[model samples]
Target: MGKTPAELSIPAASISTEIPDIPVSIPSQLLERRPDIAVAERQVAAANAQIGIAKAAYFPTVNLSATNGFQTGTLSNLFTTAARYWALGPAAFALPLFDAGARGAQMAASIDAFDASVAAYRQTVLTGFQEVEDQLAALRILEQETEIQNKAVALAQEALKLTSNQFQAGTIGYLEVMTAQVVALDNQKAAIALLGQRLDASVLLIKALGGGWQASEIPNRDKIGGKTKWSQFLPIPIR
Candidate 1:
């Protein structure tokens, strides 16, 4: 049976808890998810695998081959040990000293793929930043709006109650009471809708940031810069 997503995932305990928790300054918790980070990481691994495949093309391939044959003038000779001849030897080596740009094409393709992956990773990071910023801004605005709406609802509800009492006292008609009630309901609904929007925006921001991929866990710039060959294959900027 195949491993489930949770089973296949890196253990949470292996990750450092030194990374700070996401702050709840804004209503959205979306950036905390970091879905894009995980995607970029996977892309980096795939690009590295591709690079390995490309590098293999530059190395000489060696193979061992063996053969056993039996020649018999009679059916009885087929089962005789003397009738069998066995041979074993290293197979031929056809090293590609040069191809009509085949190796060059492969190298170029691999490099291009690496470059593309880097770009994609950068874009994902930028997108994450943008989402967080936008969501934070939206959250702030929505919070303010919600507060205003709540006040409006409260005021409308008080007005409706007052109008109701006045109608019962025969100082106002039923229509006035109905109008106030409708206004209060509308304000309450608007507040609820704004609250929902804030929640949605938070979720979106979390997804953009690459859910659970903590920025603090990223290796230092110096360490990333020191790496020569394999590290270059990483999709995201290791720093």
Candidate 2:
């Protein structure tokens, strides 16, 4: 069947297949593939970068200024060398030897923020794995349940036919025919409900798998350790 645009967005690797005994994924492996976890990882990176920004305050600040203009009030003497004047070389430096431990406090706070992001990322992975497992179990149980319902419906249908034939031949009462009819309808209704449940489970299972996404696609710390440009981050949105 054709896929919707939203469905197409999931990575093909994350989709369900007909193969049996699909292996469960490692926790770290699932963390890499989930976009929510990738976003958390980026938050960690951003928090680490803030640490550098805080440390930068400890460096010296450079003050630079320059001025050049005609000194004479009269417009006539504005172009003359005698009236021309300029001032420069008043640059100064202010080193931040200390800030009453403010820098240290900022660094510590950044470290804590990074740690929190890492913890969030782990929780996201755990939650994602749990959802996948839950759906898998649901699908399995419902599959068997649907099969049983199918058998019940078929039996009910056959019994109803037999009852109808017997009633027409005056071997059974009208009440027996009505009872068989009700049983057949109830079993068929149950089968329909089971089919709907399986569809719901399939969709949930796909979502848990990150729509065919893989963790390897998320960038690691090593990729951002060097001189990186703003444009380099364009290809992948945090989510």
- Candidate 2: the clashing residue pairs are 10-211, 11-211, 11-212, 14-212, 32-215, 33-214, 33-215
Question: Against the correct fold, how does model 1 do in TM-score?
Answer: 0.57
Alpha-carbon local distance difference test for all models: 0.71, 0.76
Q: Best candidate, lDDT-wise?
A: 2
RMSD of each: 16.1, 11.7
Q: How does each model score on TM-score?
A: 0.57, 0.65
Candidate 2 lDDT over residue span 186-226, tens digit each: 99889878888888887777677766435455445554344
lDDT of 1 by residue, 1-239 (tens): 49885577653342122212356543333342455555675687678678889988988987779999997899988978989998998687768887898987898898889889988977877777787778668767877887888899889989998999999999988899889978987987787787678778667655555453345544443433344566566967554
